[model samples]
Target: MGVPTLVCAPHRLLRRIEAGYLDNPYHNAVHAADVLQTLHVIVHGARLHVHYLDPLGLLAAYLAANHHCAAAFELLTRHTELDVLEPLSTADKAALRKLVIELVLATDMKQHFSTLTHFNTVHQLASTKSFAAAGSSGEGLLKSAPGGRLANVQQEFKEALYADGGPDGAAFASGGPDAAAAAPAPLDDSERLLSLQVALKVADLGHLAEQMEVHKRWLAALEAEFFLQGDLERQMGLPISPLFDREKQGVSKSQVGFFEFVALPLANALSSAFPGAQPLMECLTSNYRHWRRAEREAAAAAAQQQASAAAATAAIN
Candidate 1:
């Protein structure tokens, strides 16, 4: 915030970031902008400014939202686009760079379980402290100690993250049985830093919390990107990932799975942590229902086609 002389730094950096993103339907500058806007809404709506975050925290959150694809961007552009840091003092630049990198990397889907586990542990500890302070009577919890109530709400998110075999469960792991074997290592800084990391990760997937039309457009863009990947995979003679295989993967079906495994859990966790952001959970639920209905319709159409084929064969016989 102090780097007044470098007012255009963000714009220049965003330009570089935008150029780095591939010309895919999704994972491009527009999606980045969408996430940034959503992050602003969540931060303001939840009144995070009034509670846990400081200036640095807010800056990191905004950077994380806009540059969640920094790793991919770097690979595509062969540059880090960190020139914006030039405006700050050397020490401050280094610290901010580190924070930005950590926040961006936390958005990787592979880290989902580990990140949730760490956040859950922090939430649990905070809840324990708040409950002890509240004692047997939870009567004056919010009225007496607002911070304690906030902590409890944050801790309650852990339940949603791990509910009904969430991202951590055997079903979602790509590493086979060995994946679930390693427990999440305890995070050292179970404080503001951890909360910010969790918040940024949730914000990166903020599309799932948007209104129906916005969510549908983003989903279509993502599906188109996936199809493009499938095309590349075919050209390279490599096996395409299931969701990326346009021939085999139905957008509605794949989206339903994505919502179940990733979006819903994240939205629920964030909503629990920030009660004011509960509307995000509602949006996620609505999206899920929409996708589920689409999936059913797709399945019904396939079944009808198969029945027609069977009847034609019977008539020929």
Candidate 2:
């Protein structure tokens, strides 16, 4: 944790970042701060700190948390007075920038499934290797006490995630007796970076795991933002995106869909890897239940209104 002092004051840098965010109901400065705090909780509460991530990796994760957009990076680089990373060596600075950019880009929903798949694969491979090393098969391990098997796999997964080299590092280093001729060992940074990406993605959607009231507030803000965008598109004679047209989208029903299709899967995967993060999963589950109930109530109310309208028409007839 021996990260060097920043060239600029932390408060000043934060102020600049906040200013750069748009004045949207959602996806604004407050959302960025929320993500930063959520990522911090995941890193520390999930025991990722005990892993092999160096200060640079941690720095990248924090920076990427607030700077998920390309424009945010431009803002940091454009203003010399706000260049908090100016104190680092050239190589370190470049490496940090690259990692931050990758992590930020990884937050895009387009990468969601692939990123989750990669994370699952990493842990799966680690568990398989661990089982092999113990001279046992995964099926045999599964037959053992659930608690014992989970603990063993969790420990091995943590080690694999933090390993400084790939699982095939030995093969990469030994080129058939010509060690020097072997390809250079792959960087373990990929593993660490993937973990950071997962943390950021989870944090980007952190509001979904908040208590019901807080989650409701965030959902309202997000819907407001989407409706605003839809309004703009309408004014411009452009097509409104799905879930953006306020008139057509049912808020509670949409929330239920999002929780089922997007939020739960990622949160569940993370909790599976780090049991310490089960609270996030638990919150999400409770919130999902709330939305499902809300959706049902809304549907019932609509049906009642329709029935009342039909009764009134029949009376007039």
Candidate 3:
């Protein structure tokens, strides 16, 4: 009834996220929700005919949605605010709570290296085999997703993943755990890692796939968070994001850049690997254009604000 785990599980996880995150811009619960929603879209698409439906995938999606929740609970338990979550239990809830936590930890940016490598070397092969069998059966290949820019996106996905060196090796390395470890990395163009990266990246940008109004609300929330985080990071002497403020480096950009650069390439690859999934690729491709245009317009707005501030100062002087 109602996903059984929805009752207590969310509350517990939120506790951990709220505590640990204390409200960061990019990695909060909203971002987690976006990832899960993105995964849902991919899963339900007619193309990419995944067989065996990756139990891990479903588990991971649930975990992503609740990652912030886990952090919230961590904060609560640490502070002995345990009573705050008393109303959420149901046995199934407890089990899912545990399950969700494990999966969430596994999804951490810190584990991306080993996680991504394993995905390329192992999970990719296994999943491919599984999909192949499903296609070989009478169902025949995926029926092609309903209309969308699935093909365009798939092509870009393939280019990024299947590239000779592997997507701007430097770009991939700069993300997640590998950031502090290495220097001038080689492009990996490894098919496996690309696929996983694509999955995570799409999840990061899933907010765009939402209904326009819902999507706008998410953008507002994210913008508010970015400003908050930027101010806090400046006060704390931390890095600022380029997307938010190129002049200061407190994580100025969200993963939207990743979507613009990476999504289409990875989507293309997926389409090639599984011909029936063309529609997903197309949707992703079109999505990229939208984000790129939005970025340009946003930059203009910021410039206008700066200009107005300058004019006010000049008048005062």
Candidate 4:
């Protein structure tokens, strides 16, 4: 909330970040800004400032929102343009850089399951601590009940990060498989940082929280990106990713499954943690229904086309 002033050098940095972003339909500077705005809405709607986050935490969230894709771009091109952060004190700049990198790297799709697992574990610990505190007072419950459990959960998260080969398991942070291995452990409040990582992730997919038209546009852009990748893979003689092979993948059906398997669960988890964020879950539900209808229509049209072709062949025969 108050951290915007602290950063104070965003325009130059944003321009640099924009310059480095891929020229894709999505995952560009515009998309980054969109996600940043969505993160603001989520933070406000969830009353994160009032409940879960301090000023520093909010700052980290905002930084993560803005720079979520910067690491990828940097890694890909070996860009050092993030020097716009130089306006801050040396220590502050370094901290912000590390935090932004960690948060951004956590957005890698490959890390999705492990990130969610860590978030869920932290969430459970928070719930247990809250319940224990409710029953007693003055840290007594924290000390007697969930203290050991909290330590264990934190350790597990740390171990998961190491297993992924980074302080933040930011496997893609430096474009190297093991670049993050030498990075120092995260310095912020571990629980708060983990939650913010998850929040930034949800915000990155915040198109699912938009209205149907907006959501469809984003989906189309993403599909275009996927198809582009598939085209490249074909040209390079590499196996194409599922749903990226535009010739065979039905966008509607794939989207339906994506929502059912990925988007909905993420929305449900966020809404559970921050009740005020239920609007996101509602929007996700609406989007899922729209996709399901599209999927059914697509299936029917394909079936009809097949039937008509078969009939014509029989008549000719």
Per TM-score, the best of the predicted structures is 2
The candidates, ranked best first by TM-score, are: 2, 1, 4, 3
Model 2 lDDT per residue over 1-317, tens place: 36888778767877877877789898888988988888777666565666635767766644665654566567777888977777788888788878888888889999997898787666555556554556643332122212223456545434433344332212211122221221112136687677778878998998887755676788899889989989999999999988888789645447777776677667766666665555565556666666667777989999999999999999999
Candidate 1 collision pairs = none
lDDT of 3 at 63: 46
Error of 3 at 81 (Å): 18
The parts of candidate 3 lying over 4 Å away from their true place are 1-31, 46-50, 54-61, 68-201, 211-217, 239-241, 244-257, 270-277, 291-317
The alpha-carbon lDDT assigned to residue 198 of candidate 1 equals 62
- What ranges in model 4 sit over 4 Å off? 1-9, 51-90, 129-188, 297-317
When 2 and 4 are scored with lDDT, the better candidate is 2
Each model's lDDT comes to 0.59, 0.67, 0.45, 0.60
Instruction: Summarize candidate 1's per-residue lDDT along 202-249 as a digit string, tens digits.
Output: 667777656667667877888888888889999999998777888775
> In candidate 4, where is summed lDDT lowest over 10 consecutive residues?
166-175
Give the best candidate by lDDT.
Answer: 2
Clashes (N, CA, C under 3 Å) per candidate: 0, 0, 59, 0
Could you report the Cα RMSD, in angstroms, for every candidate shown? 10.9, 12.1, 13.7, 12.9
Q: Is candidate 1 or candidate 2 better by TM-score?
A: 2
TM-score, candidate 1, is 0.69
Which stretch of 10 consecutive residues in model 3 shows the poorest summed lDDT? 138-147
Cand. 4 Cα-lDDT:
0.60
